[model samples]
Target: MDNYRFILSGGGTGGHIYPAIAIANELKERFPDAEILFVGAKDRMEMEKVPQAGYKIEGLWISGVQRKLTPKNLMFPLKVISSLVRSASILNKFKPHAVIGTGGFASGPLLKVASVKGIPCLIQEQNSYAGITNKLLADKVKKICVAYEGMDKFFPKDKIVKTGNPVRSDLISLSENRDNAMQFFNLDMDKPTLLVLGGSLGARRINELIEDKLSFFKTFGLQLIWQCGKLYYEEYKKYDSEEVKVYPFINRMDFAYTATDMIISRSGAGAVSELSIVGKPVIFIPSPNVAEDHQTKNAKALVAENAAVMIAERDLDTEFEEDFTDLMLTKNRQQELSDNIKRMSLPDATKRIVDEIEKMLGKG
Candidate 1:
């Protein structure tokens, strides 16, 4: 009974992929002999990341349907059919005890096939707003684990569990990492540090805003640990200096979090979840291009509770400086935001999710 087999399917973005990995890690820790597999879209970040995490992964020939009438849209049906067939074959071979989905196009076909085959299935929805894929699979899955309340609006009331999002284990305890983090990032302990995260792929608007305000930030004697993302690294590398350390991607987020005093980031669910644990003062500039403006809704939820600050992309030009200055200059305000956000952190989220998995599999 301890030797459970599970398939974790989700990808397309780090928000979805990292949660799956965290869950997989927790499962491995609990059942050391468990056989875990990952299913993700071919050519996506998960294909690379999952392997890097020391797990086997199979890639589906799949991608999300584009909003516009493009050639890829024409191939959507074909892709879906192909993914379903492959999923069925994989399930037949693995005969997993259960399947867990995070949220992405790849998870849709795999979870559907697994559920139809009578395998117990569960899904974790990281965002406050439900994703289209999770919404479609809600009725089929046995349990829906979610980070935010009011998810009953999208899922069956009886099946929903508020377990929060699964953040990486390394991020759970950062209080002891400040000195090591500062040394690793070559940051001065005397001056305040600002961490800039634009999610996994970098935000063009956020990057532009940072580039524009470099001098203004320097005026306050603030040092920066800027993660401009891989795509924009070349364009922004010229700005890297002693006071500003520019990275294409931050591999050591634990260090990044521990070294920084404040953060300016995209309000993607994964970022929001991780930031809560880091417990730093944050100004969320949610990405507007996402589906249904989910990022804005995520940021607003925290702002409503006075857990964080938010400035929309449209209002950045006029409001960003004033907002950033106020947050930076006020110590009491920073501590208040930090305290409130930390109170919102579910540091045991990964374990709770794994507990749900154990119960579903009758292994608890």
Candidate 2:
């Protein structure tokens, strides 16, 4: 793998950014001498996060085409044109061995340019349902790495590899940190813990449900570790009490997972992958806002195997509290969910993806 440089693109949310970072981290470990550069949409989280992760990143003036006719939609064509030109310049200057996309609008132009240049291109789709960007680039990508099975419905069957999402290494062997984690969160270890996560920016529906039912947590004698996301934190901060530990974000998620007896979460691809590996009993509230309702599809995949329980966002008002209360009280159900979810985990996904890349590079 001589003359190897890497260009990684994808970022609009942590789901995209974290997976790209995970792959970049894996590549760095395998190819320490390889120059890695990140390309992401300007003014997005990746611009800040990529640098924070100790990598060089360049931003392209790109934004998604709005589904509704809006002022932003008018600028879509110009932005796409500018982004493609800029991506070509970056690719030309860096001469990367491979261009990897992790599924976001910014990746569309960048990966399209790399494919045109005949650079080996790979994409990691972190959803059960394919995003428009990944689907559009599917024919051009040399290989497609995915977390869900039956993705041949979206991409070419021969090009697809069912590599589960790469979780943070710290999470893989997370063991025996229950007390430390509870102390860190200032939670009570004597009480059964319920950890609720609704993605990095937070889920408004989930937040609202928690807000309305904050007192219901006491019913099960449960300690709460609730990440209310930045948007809802201010409103939810008032609910923080001795039994409830509330935060805008949890930096050490592995600790939170280790400390908890159960999890309440949105079944995003990354969250599902991590939860499966962590093997915690989960109550999934699939976000309806995502493309193709992929979050619901993801949740169903596990629910079908009796690995998780799904509560629709719309049903949360009437159903969530009751379902959650019953779930928390049922120890047998929790153990069953934990065991079944763990059975579906693919912890070696990072290694498998790297192996595929190396095989494509003919140096494995």
Candidate 3:
């Protein structure tokens, strides 16, 4: 067990990809001699990102089936067959001690193949709702690590472990980075600041809402750190000035979290986990377009706990101003939210997940 081999598979979005990378990082740290390989769908972000994180990865010729009938949908069976063949070949060559899946289309084929080969397998489900791929792999997986409660509906109760999502290590501590954050964003520390996040690619509705509410935010003397995403950065960068800073992406999220007093964000599982660790008062506007409206479900879980505020995308136009105003004006409510959300954070999630992997490999 001194020189173990593990395969980490998942990726379509950062929500799936980062957790896999986080787990890989921990395994590397604890087992320096371990061989880690990532498997993801070809042409997806993981193909690029996993390598950037310093891991070798193999790409499967697979993608998710679309809802409507299309050429891509028609080719789904062929893609699955191809992916299975590739996955089987990979497992045969790599012969990993355990295979870890974080849930995306690529993981479906790989984990399915791994489990069938009788290799030890574990999957991390990052959402309140289990994804189609993870659901399909549930019966076969040795253990299911989940971020939310009540996931037994999708997974077997006997196999479930409520280990929170793996968040990036840099986000765990933000207090000491405040001065650097303030200087980095070039915002006055005396003024209250709001951080707006619209997920990785950016949300059009969120960008529009910010544009419409800029004058209102100015009235409250609120400064802004807006991450409009690369797709919309050009369109929104004109608003950047003394009071507002615009970024296509914030490379240093630790700084961004440390500097902000409050956040307005999409409630993707990754964002929810990171914000909880950041411990800032947040107004979650969950994306309506995702599968199963899971973003809303994820936000509602926190809202039910009084840990965060959630405003559906459909309700944003009608309720955002009042909700935003109420939270901003109530100092005690803000403190309550910050405290509650912080309580929801699982700072050791990455370690906990790796612990599961170790147990699967009999190295626990």
Candidate 4:
């Protein structure tokens, strides 16, 4: 393992980006002198976020195909060709022992190059249903680290390893931070707190739902800590008051988890993974706009385990109040959901993923 070098690529969203960073961070802890390089799409968040994590990253000239036919779709082949050439050039220069793809536009090219070069390559899929990029690269990669079971439907069963998503290291042990969390959000410790996450950019429906229900939430004597997301901050900021804390995005997510008695969230892979660790009684409102509507599938996996409750996007308008009221009134239901979700958590996800990487490289 001396002087081990690795290439990891993923981005476009925090769900993909943070896992790649967590894997890179874990690698550094194991081999302090190890050289880790990140490859990400040019102009994507990873270009900025990866560098902020203290890792060197190169940007690929790449983007995903639009679901609808567009003039931009005409440029897809050229971007793919340009990215593949650049990825090969990168692998040739870095000469890494292995490569990891956490599923993003850039990872497709980067891992394709690494797999063709006969280098050990692994991919981490964060959802219950596989993403388009990972599905295309499935056979080429050596191992697939996953957070959900029954991924055999998407990936080769022999290559699959059910390792959960790596949560932010700072988010662990939130129970111990309860007092600090209360002060952090400046919320009343006596009232039950409801934390709503709409993701970094925001979800239109979730924001609209909250906009319409702020009074309903207030009537229940429920204190709210709402991450309205950057896009909707201006529209929703007026709702912020002594009982409701509003922010464009949350910096202290650990505190948010600790302070909340209930969670209303969009069920992305990262959110589900983190909440499974937080062990809160969450009511998942899965976004319907994603590829394969996988957020709903991600939530369903937990619902089957009795780890959380779920409502489809179409059902939210008609069903949210009744569902929410039932959850709030049932004290044992909260503890039951919390305990079950915690049981499904994999605290050692990063460690387990890296263990597979080591095994792949024959350094296990």
Candidate 5:
């Protein structure tokens, strides 16, 4: 183990990409001299993001199979075989000590090749409802790190480690910055602040819903910090004013979390995990566009625990105002959601996943 080398694979979306980057970061911190390489789908976000995170990455020609039969489905087999061949080539050359996957088309082939090569591998499953890639590789990997309970339904119980998803470390510690946060956002602390996140690219339904309720929000006496996302900033920038501060993206997310009293967001696994750490009463608007309606399922997990509220994208027109009104006025309900979500947070998840990796290498 003198020259520890590791390969991480995942992509397609931020959900799959960030966790791999987070784990790679932690491994770099612990083993400063170790070589960490990333493998991601060629055209996906990870090729850019991984490099931004200061790691070299190799791309595989890969994409997920479409749900409905279409022309793209014909390319599926060729893509998989090509990806498998490419992944095998990379594995042979890198000769990685361990390969880690965070669930995407690229990871499927990369981890499968590594496993066949007798390399120990691990996967971090972000959602309560496991993704197809992770499920397929469950038995092949040495360990399965998950963000939710009962993932035994997907992976072997003996192999599953209940480590929550890794989030930006800066987000985990900001409790002492409230006063500075308020000033930074130029927000008045007298009004109850609502933070709205539509994710980095922005959710179309959430943006439209916010547009429909702008006047009503002011009537409800709430100030807002809205992240309309980079994709829809121009469409929603008109809403920005004294009471509603709108941005394409909030780079200073820790400050945004600190300044706000409550959150209205899309309940992707990453958002759910970060919100749990922020310990705010959150109203989730899960995107219906995702595969298997997983966002709604992710939100339902917290709703079951009384840790969050949810309004389906289709139900937003009918349920948004009423549910938000009741939650906003009910002080005790707010506290209950906040406290319970905090209990669900796993701030040490990155460290825990790295611990499991070390154990696999007989270094634990």
Candidate 6:
């Protein structure tokens, strides 16, 4: 009996869930006989997403602590205690050979328990600024896999491995049939296409900026493929027309990347990784709502190296039109960003992460 169990934990958002699944899928490919269990916070998107990915999952009664006063926060301590207990029970029953966390509230408790059991654990920090959960669990975990540099300030220098964030495999190697992608999107091949993405749930500021400036997009003879995200679809769909295709979600990211000449998007770690691989000229609008303003930091790292352009969310009202128009007109600037960002890409992140996992388990 191989009896080697692997426990993968992360939730709350696609950034955390997808990476955990990517790592789990890679592990299963290498060790088909190993048992795998996913642990996520109850009622989060992961409870649904993980199962859909063909993995068994358990949900912890855990929630993030509120930064401000709220009635719901009254149960924070209780939830934490219950989650810790549940995590220990799950670890006892599963008896995992190793545990992996990709930065989420549920991962904190689950990996903490795994660490206490003397099991080998790996933490994947996807952002330029470390997430609170991963930061808290840094010392406890045996290995820290990260996507950005200068992370020694967040985790132990010895434990850090600069494995770039894992993106969907297809995204790394885009199937370069641009004509086919254009046909699929019903877009003109001659016009420069702009792809605007606000992630799975959407960004309010980005959506508003696009709606406000949509009329201006036509002036440049540019076509638009907009992912408005599910949250803002109803409000933004009214603006969609023949030249502007508005989608709430895009499952075929490879096609999306291929069909576009330029991209306007939030600077989430996952989006940044995918963009680096696609090597398109990008205008980043980092969300202000994230913890520690990590998205801005992620964008700044790229901008510092001339890899991309960033417009702070608050500055969008004043600078978006000018910045966007300048980029569209300047072919030299676009090519420069494309070339520099491609230099920062790590398309084999999934392989690197899996290799580390295998090494930690002494199976390499």
Worst 10 residues of 5 by lDDT: 172-181
TM-score of 1: 0.96
TM-score of each: 0.96, 0.96, 0.98, 0.97, 0.98, 0.97
Candidate 1 colliding pairs: none
lDDT (tens digit, per residue) of candidate 3 on 1-364 = 5589999999999999999999999999999999999999999999999999999999999999899889999899999999999999999999999999998999999999999999999999999998999999999999999999899999999999888988988778765567788998899989999999997678999999999999999989999999999999999999999999999999888888888999999999999999988899999998889988999999999999999999887898899999999999999999999999999999899999888888887778
lDDT of 5 by residue, 314-355 (tens): 788888899999998899999999999999999999999999
In candidate 5, which residue ranges exceed 4 Å CA deviation?
A: none
lDDT of 1 by residue, 16-116 (tens): 99999999999999899999999999999899999999999999999988898999999999999999999999999999999999999899999999999
lDDT (C-alpha, whole model) for all candidates: 0.93, 0.90, 0.93, 0.93, 0.92, 0.92
Error of 1 at 247 (Å): 1.7
Which model, 1 or 5, shows the larger TM-score?
Answer: 5
- Model 2 reaches what TM-score against the true structure? 0.96
lDDT of candidate 4 over 1-364, digit per residue (tens): 4599999999998899999999999999988989999999999999999999999999999999998999889999999999999999999999999999999899999999899999999999999999999999999999999999899999899999988999999866665567898998888888999999989988888888888898888778999999999998998898889999989999988888888999999999999999999998999999988889989999999999999999998998899999999999999999999999999999899999999998997877
Question: Per-residue CA lDDT of candidate 6, range 1-364, in tens?
Answer: 3457999999899999999999988888877898999999999999999999999999999999889999879999999999999999999998899999999999999999899999999999999999999999999998999998899999999999999999888877787699999988899889889999999888888888888787899889989999999998998888778789999999888888999999999999999998999999999999899889989999999999999999998888889889988998899999999999999999889889988988888877
TM-score, predicted candidate 4 vs. hidden true structure: 0.97
lDDT, candidate 6, residue 86?
97
Displacement of residue 1 (Cα, Å) in model 6 is 8.3
lDDT of 2: 0.90
TM-score of 3: 0.98
| Candidate 2 ranges with C-alpha deviation above 4 Å | 1-3
